[model samples]
Target: MSQHQILNPADHAQLRIHTEAGAEFGDNVMASLAMPAEFREVQAHYPIVFRRDAETGKLAALALFGFEAGENLFLNGSTWEARYRPMAHAVQPFLIGRAAEEGAPPQVHVDMGHARVSATGEGMRVFDDTGTATPYLEAVANMLGDLDYSWHESDAFFTALETYELVEPFSLEVTLDNGSVQTLVGFQTIHEERLSALDGDALAALMAEGHLARIYMVLASLAQFGGLVARKNRRIALG
Candidate 1:
């Protein structure tokens, strides 16, 4: 039987956001997008939530979906003892600990206090009093669907990707200046592996001899060489 190729958008969405910049996107959104999917399956059960600022009434940040487990309550990492709390806050009670004392809470807050890049080519760095540092700027230029050299014009995008590792099907929901959220999906590939396979001692010499092109080209070439894998229910086959 010939192998059948199946493209599942959900599978690519479930990757972890270990990077500080990525965590700002929120757990609910990431989990919803990242969970692996079977053919003909519906969307994820949980809804991506955005937190509102008490003072401003604006959608300030995202949520990590911390809920009470029982007599013993559980947040993301820290554990809390359950108590008789008000009905309104019973589901996600506020913990009284170092994180709460610092007013950071269990959720990853984004906006003025986190990494931000301006459309006008300006950048800023933000730090919380609790020693959390965020570098604000367009660190990378990510092109989805197909690889193109035209994106190399942007300084921040170019500089960031120059030495960065490529992770496939990168999903991100960016909050725009007007408080609108935009979702981006993309892929990544690295040059280190390809360069290491070559017989070279000098790193500079490798680049001078067109190593970058070879790396990126190899990634695309995988499609031609049947490196792409097709998956269906109970089966994974080469495409």
Candidate 2:
């Protein structure tokens, strides 16, 4: 259960958030929601794919960390192996909340029940003694802002892909050195053939909206699959 509360210095003065990456802090996940704004950095570390919401039928991008659920290949001990973690994953235990009034600005809300919510005073303070937001809190706020904006804007990006039929079902079967096999399905990726076949006008529209570059980033990120498999193989060998 989540205990989300509006973050305020008065109410959360002594709250300290555990900043390390580990399963206890809910870091052991196969994937995270990816935003197009961060695709350039994400592409260098994780494979980007798309998944559709069963209820809304809306497409959302994901940055793959492993082939199976609860298996984060990039997680080693208490550290995240990747140099760049997707903002959605980085901004954990805190989320953007809106006010009851219409058009009110977003508020920072913290999950008091999260493991990262340090109960024994073992992590970074959210606010200083003077009730001022600490540098850590400031950074989290920025990440939340970026994530909120990018997530909403992602709808247009996905819509453009859908309109052009540029997405296709994707699946992968990995064979580890130990003869263990893993299969991944129910994902989608950019359809290179359809994208290439788009006429000049379609290309110009996508380029004008800056979706073309992001599309290419998703394509480029597929290369990281090999590295992901290598990480899995290493883990198996170690065991």
Candidate 3:
């Protein structure tokens, strides 16, 4: 029942950022550039700044570091790409203003794109395809024919969403299961989006009734259960 703490202001400053940690895929670790002081009175939020190889200091991802105008801001590393550069420029001013307030320098920043590095020394790879990326709970529900196994009923599947009151935005798709000949897209929550959706009202309500801890617990549980399994790339040897 522990409460979530907004990362402290000081901790953000001290982190050294890096895109490639080593030869291993997941070995690429990110850290602070040089910890900053607790100067800003406001709760400052800044995009992750990566340390560049050419220079010893931190470098901002190009997708997030400059100004263009009238565009969407790319926040997650997954969404950063050539297609998103224009959007990043649109919000450049706002980002710069925030960065200035935090006394953070800017470098070329970009989104990490939709990819995850395996802990093993494998190369970069996509985590999931559109057909099957739903969270485990939702996947199970869909695979087993709705949360209550009432797929035969008209509204059983849709009712699950209403019942869970999914507070977060998640991707769902219907696809074929290897053993079963059915296609289904199960529900999966987007962590960053869900966190962003928390408003002052929600926060106050959660904290007031000890439900805040429960919410976090549920999220953690979901994360552990909800992961996309990449079946294609996996190699299975049959004797």
Among these predicted structures, which one has the highest lDDT? Answer: 2
The worst-scoring run of ten residues by lDDT in candidate 3 lies at 34-43
TM-scores vs. true structure, each candidate: 0.17, 0.98, 0.21
State the local distance difference test value for candidate 3. Answer: 0.27
Q: Which candidate's TM-score is highest?
A: 2
Error of 2 at 46 (Å): 0.1
How would the candidate models be sorted by lDDT, starting from the highest? 2, 3, 1
All candidates' lDDT scores?
0.25, 0.95, 0.27
Ranking by TM-score: 2, 3, 1
Put down candidate 2 lDDT per residue, 118-169, tens digits, no spaces: 9887999999999999999999999999999998898889999999999999
Question: How displaced is residue 57 in candidate 1, in Å?
Answer: 43
Per-residue error (Å), model 3, residue 131:
54
List model 1 lDDT by residue over 37-109, tens digit each.
1101111111222232358642211111222112111122232212221111221111112244565533222
Stretches of candidate 1 exceeding 4 Å from the true structure: 1-128, 131-216, 223-227, 232-239
Task: Enumerate clash totals for all models, in the order shown.
Answer: 7, 0, 34
Can you write out model 3's per-residue Cα lDDT over 1-239, one digit (the tens) per residue?
A: 22222222232222122223222212122211211111010002222211233564222221112111222122223333222222222211111111435655332221222122123434322212333322422332233322112212313212332233433334333232443222212223324454556679866754675444433443443321112112211211110
Model 3 residue 108 CA deviation in Å: 64
